[model samples]
Target: MPKRDRSKRTDPTAVMVRIVVADDGTLTVSVDGAPYLPPEFSPPWRRASFPAIVDAISQQTGRTLRVDVIETDGRTITDFYTPRTPRKAEPQTSAAESSVQAASAAEPAPAPRLMQFAGSGMIPGEEVAVAIIIAHAESGPDGIARTLIDSRYLEHSPTGEAVLLGRISATVCVGQPQ
Candidate 1:
């Protein structure tokens, strides 16, 4: 009888975790800096939330693991260390080419820009989504007050339900008034 490979039988620890907070309240967690994949088991590899996985590891290890949260633009984000070491990459494509590929892979097709607004006077959560939007716009210069809304946000707060519509007037001129 042939002996089985023992190395392949053990599950590996994650090396790094990347968390992204969209303009909306949707939080996405990726393992090993891999692209986000739906929570499924068929592929043998799937994306999972950092906190959930950490909790599981803690239970198994019988020790509490600490994670550091880094914030960029007022969002709570964190990364955890894993035992697995990443393999070195072979340079094949130029930076520009890689950028082009990333841009193309991001969206199959571009959609028209649409502006929508939503708000709630009282909510259970810390109102992270609302604060994120205002901070995003405020960080930029004038005339740049727009944010991309995802399907998840729309589903939670529909078009005209917990949202209100209003407009503000401003004037712009190239040169001094004559």
Candidate 2:
């Protein structure tokens, strides 16, 4: 019998970069088959790898991505990092619908928590034009609609109302307080 060749053949479709989230919520990043941060590092160090890798992937992919985390029996895989479009606000949500959402809170796997980040405030830093997506909050029973925007990033409110993105409307407030 002929002896088999010892050299390993490389898989062409393999992704050299990997993002792993362990069952203990430990996030690890490996680049080109090397640990971006070693296993002996603290959680903080592990987390610090996120931004750098994200920036690199963003540069390569040319897309804004949301990290969807998955936790299985003994391992957590951050395999759901997909390009995502920002969500638009619905015109209204009935009180009954809110109650239903509250009722469905119990489950082994809950829905991923969604977050909105926006702001408007001046800084001494470099001035760069930024395109921001915002979701308008629902109006209160008082019929007063309020929109929350960060003052740090505050360029200005929309001059008039229109669908900002999808069904979401933009609420403009005049002369915001300091």
Candidate whose TM-score is highest? 2
Query: lDDT per model, in order?
Result: 0.37, 0.41
Top candidate (lDDT) = 2
**TM-score versus the correct structure, for each prediction:** 0.24, 0.28
Which regions of candidate 2 fall more than 4 Å away from where they truly are?
A: 1-15, 38-48, 55-152, 159-178
Off by over 4 Å in 1: 1-14, 36-50, 56-178
Compared with the true structure, what per-residue lDDT tens digits does model 2 show for residues 51-126?
4566665565544444432322433334323334447987787999888877876545534333223223311111
TM-score, model 1 to reference: 0.24
- For model 2, give the 10-residue run with minimal summed lDDT: 122-131
On residues 6-102, what C-alpha lDDT tens digit does candidate 1 reach at each position?
Answer: 8755444433445554444245545445554545763322112333555554454443233433333554544444433347998799999999999
Count the clashes in each prediction: 1, 10
Local lDDT at 119 for model 1? 34
Residue range with the least summed lDDT across 10 consecutive positions in model 1: 169-178
Q: Compared to the true structure, candidate 2 yields what TM-score?
A: 0.28
lDDT of 1 at 169: 13
